[model samples]
Target: MELRLTLSLTAALLLPGLAIAADAHADTAPAASRQAELPAWEQLSAEQRELLISPLRDRWNAQPQERARMLEHAKRWKALPPEARERARKGVHRFEQMDPEQRRIARAIFAATRDMSPEQREQFRKDWARMSPAQRQEWLRKHPAPEGGRGR
Candidate 1:
């Protein structure tokens, strides 16, 4: 998938986009700049600071290419229209609220559909709509998310 689409899906499916973007490039910043920025970070309430810090820490710990990609993705996210950003934010929030099984179902659907043609996606939706709750659960049990996927 294209990086932008992948980021959109991952952000919508996995984490909130705007918050993570802020932390993406922190490590590449010069030391003096970081030092100069410390007080601003300190001024934030612990909750506010954590909103930014955790993502930065994750970025810092990522493989070099992954870090660079995350930074790039963050930049792209920043450039999105406000409505688009809001939509993604809401999507992340909804995803965050799902029970693990629901999230697994979501991830399964996402993985199954991400690469589909329009017609194929339509057909899958039709098939999905035909399944009873138990059947849906059975389908999901047969096709669990890849190891450690979907917030596991």
Candidate 2:
């Protein structure tokens, strides 16, 4: 079943001309008639647009590589089971709730993790999984920010 879904997704991505044709027809309708189209993201309340679709829209409009990657991510998301999709949506919401400094720290951690070898990463993950709440707090306390401060 997974293989069949994977094949379907692969075919859809590889033959995007068909998708473009379908979207072209959809786009031909009068702009003012499109009720579902969102206004500028900044105009909406944060709760109303949790994930900030504006960044995705800007990337889609300006960067072909980023647009392609986003499309691929969307396809993969669509292929996920409903439960997995819900979990992913929750994760995205959590990410959106993070402050800019927290987000930057998370991104840096991710980049550092990505640079690690698979075996090292697995060991790190295992060690992290084993850490108790107290131990985690202690580790953070020991790793205090530099003289200026965390953001600095």
Candidate 3:
């Protein structure tokens, strides 16, 4: 009976360790496969990849409702003329280049703009358009850039 109890206790301790080892191996195995499958972009360091793709990818992978909204917006974007797409891509590049604080303010502005009614959005656009370049620069000056570099 003592031998049996010792064996049982040993098995109990060893079994959990084995299971944990198996789980760790299993998890890493798939990640390795995924890394292999990833494109050149995925081969980049996480920071570089995030810098290049996070905004659109995050938008795409947001919660289901938000994802649907983003998809709808993308469909509309796709329908835009090539020149418009190029212009929009330039805008996105600018946004990506902004420091974190500026990006945060821009995100807030976008959220507020998106929440506005069509007429309100149009009014905001008109107001923004009326601002002088100096005024726009001053507005941006109020928001400080993030330290320690942009989100990698």
Question: Can you write out model 1's per-residue Cα lDDT over 34-66, one digit (the tens) per residue?
Answer: 778767655878876776767667766865656
Q: Pick the candidate with the highest TM-score.
A: 1
Task: Summarize candidate 2's per-residue lDDT along 25-59 as a digit string, tens digits.
Answer: 35555657653675666786774454444445655
Model 1: CA > 4 A from native: 1-11, 14-54, 62-65, 150-152
Q: Each model's TM-score? A: 0.57, 0.40, 0.36
Per-residue CA lDDT of model 3 for 101-137, tens digit only, reads 5554454345335446768866866666677878656
Candidate 3 — worst ten consecutive residues by lDDT sum?
11-20
All models, RMSD in angstroms: 10.0, 14.0, 23.0
- Residue range with the least summed lDDT across 10 consecutive positions in model 1: 1-10
| Candidate 3 deviant stretches above 4 angstroms | 1-67, 115-152
Tell me which of candidates 1 and 2 scores higher on TM-score: 1
| lDDT (CA) per prediction | 0.63, 0.47, 0.47
